[model samples]
Target: MTTPTPVVFIHGLWLHATSWEPWIDLFQKEGYDASAPGWPGDPDTVEEARANPESIADHGIDAVVDHYASIIKDLPVAPILIGHSFGGMIAQKLLGQNLAAAAVAIDAAQIKGVLPLPLSALRATLPVFKNPANKHRAVSLTAEQFRYAFGNALSAEESDALYERWTIPAPGKPLFEAAAANFNPHSPAKVDTANELRGPLLLMTGGKDHTVPEAVTRATLKQYRHSEAVTDILDFPDRGHSLTIDGRWREVADTALDWLRRQEL
Candidate 1:
């Protein structure tokens, strides 16, 4: 029997591993081992996270990346890493360690070399960094806030339900890190995977994404221009930063799966 490749999914901020249930299911059905690792002390459900936002306050990029690194160390084989938003940043970090067979970063946050910050991305993150006290706290978004940041292109009912099911308080420190990434010379979020020859890397962008705009995605592509292995980029014109959770998530998932199949992994 042929061995299956394992896939580790890292969710974006304000979301737990459970948020990737649909993607996980699709991956499993395709004969792959898939796991979604939660941030430290993440509550099991959205309701629980909403009720006790403080539990996620201590999770920063370093801690979260280290948690996944440990998981990869114990895996039977190096797995494909897939992440979105903050999770996308984590995926880039993992790829730099040469720990994965492949990786896909969807609307990932800014790292060291990529410097374009659209107004929409700034506005989406303003709630977390607006207050000094928020540095060590978890901040949840109101419905209106969620609508603008995550559901701008979806229907009202879909937007409302997504907010109810997936929105939660996220750690503030990662936002701070992303905000200051360009200024930090030694930041791990800065990935140098251009020399990695073992696996292909894919960077995807949501064309309508205010959180991580197409311009930023193009910048990321340029940074990886020196990669020895093939580097590719995909743009979903109708999707937003919440493409993984919004109405068209399946389409995005299928796109990634298609890429994986082409690699025959």
Candidate 2:
């Protein structure tokens, strides 16, 4: 018997999993069981996360991947995974492992085999990489940094509100691990792009994004070109890294929805 499709939402750094509530609502109304589970040690609320930034510290790529992998393994059925930023990387990893029915990666962080580190991506990771010590700590973004990295398309007022509501300190270890992935042969940030067992995978990009811009997603697409399973890429012009949390989030959500529907998922 076929079980209902479960849509698992994975959130990136600086935002709680609940940030996906809007997307969840949209998916649930469309007959999908949607959920957003945070990384290990994630605080229950935005306020709690802000105050206890260090609570999620010291976790690396393997740990975060395992956390989400375990969550999906317990689901009633394979899920249609949708994730943004670092969360997007997790989606790809799970897809490589054949743990998801389908996957959508939005402005995804670079995995080990995904070559090409855009200057924008490097700049965005500066907050954590600038200080080598941050690998063992948590790093928070200031208003200007947040604006530069995520909200450039938004006004000051909109950026501030988004920051107040969604931003939180993120663990630095994962960022470090991702940065060194290509050089580290033993890096856990690798993905199995050639696995035939992997399902349809889509890469979504923000044209104006400073972090994980179109170039980055395109590079990932090139890496996945070897996959016999369907692999595609879409671009949302004028959008930034904040596309997932910004006002036009619905547009991006609908695009993903339309694609999944086409796949009969």
Candidate 3:
């Protein structure tokens, strides 16, 4: 019997591993083994995460990245790494260490080549960076906030429901780190994905996403220009940063699945 390819999913900030439940189901049906590693102390459910937001306060990029890296180390076989937003940065970091069979970064957070800081992105992150006290706290989004930053392109009911189900307080430090990434020489947000010769790397962007705009994604793609292996970019016109949870999530997952199948994993 052929061995199944392992798939590791890393969710973006304010979300836990459960955020990938639907995608995990789809991957399993396709004969793949999947695991969604939580950021340190991430609660299993949105309600629980909200109830204990303080637990996530110390989960900075380096800590979260190392936690996932440790999980990868114990895997019997190298797995395909898939991540979104901050999780994307972690995926790239893992790829840099040469740990995955392949990787897909979706609406990934600030990384090398993504230098633009659109006002909307700033506004979306303001709630976290408005005060120095937030640096060590967890910031939860209000319904209106989630609507603007995550579900802007979805229907009201769908957006509201997603907020209720997936919204949770996220560590503030990572957002601050991403905001200062370009200027900080020692930012943990930095990743040298240009060494793409390691394996197939796919960067997926949500065209209508205000948080991680298409322009930013395009800039990031340029960094991989010198990669030896396949480096590809795909944009979903109608999707927002919340593409993984909003309506039509299955469509986005299928698109990624198609790409994963082509990799011969």
The per-prediction CA RMSD against the true structure, in angstroms, equals 1.3, 1.2, 1.3
Off by over 4 Å in 2: none
Off by over 4 Å in 3: none
Instruction: Single out the weakest 10-residue window by summed lDDT for candidate 2.
Output: 218-227
TM-score of each: 0.96, 0.97, 0.96
Predictions in order: lDDT: 0.85, 0.89, 0.85
Instruction: Give one digit per residue, the lDDT tens place, for model 1 in 100-146.
Output: 99889999887778888889988988888789788799998888788
The numbered model that scores best in lDDT is 2
Residue 108, candidate 1: C-alpha displacement in angstroms? 0.9
Misplaced by over 4 Å in model 1 are: none
Error of 2 at 148 (Å): 0.6
lDDT of 2 by residue, 1-265 (tens): 6566999999887788888999999999998999999999898888898889889899887888899989998998889999999999999999999999999999999888877888988897799899999999989999889998999988988888898889888999988888889889988888998887788998999999998878778888888777789998999989999999899999999999999988889
> Tens digits of per-residue lDDT for model 3 on 1-265?
7678889999988767798999999999999998797899897777788899888896788898889888988888888998998888789888877888889999988785567888888887888888978989998888888888888888878888998888789899888777778788888888866674577888899988878888888888877777777878998998899998876889888988999888876
RMSD of 1: 1.3
Best-first order by lDDT: 2, 1, 3
Best by TM-score: 2
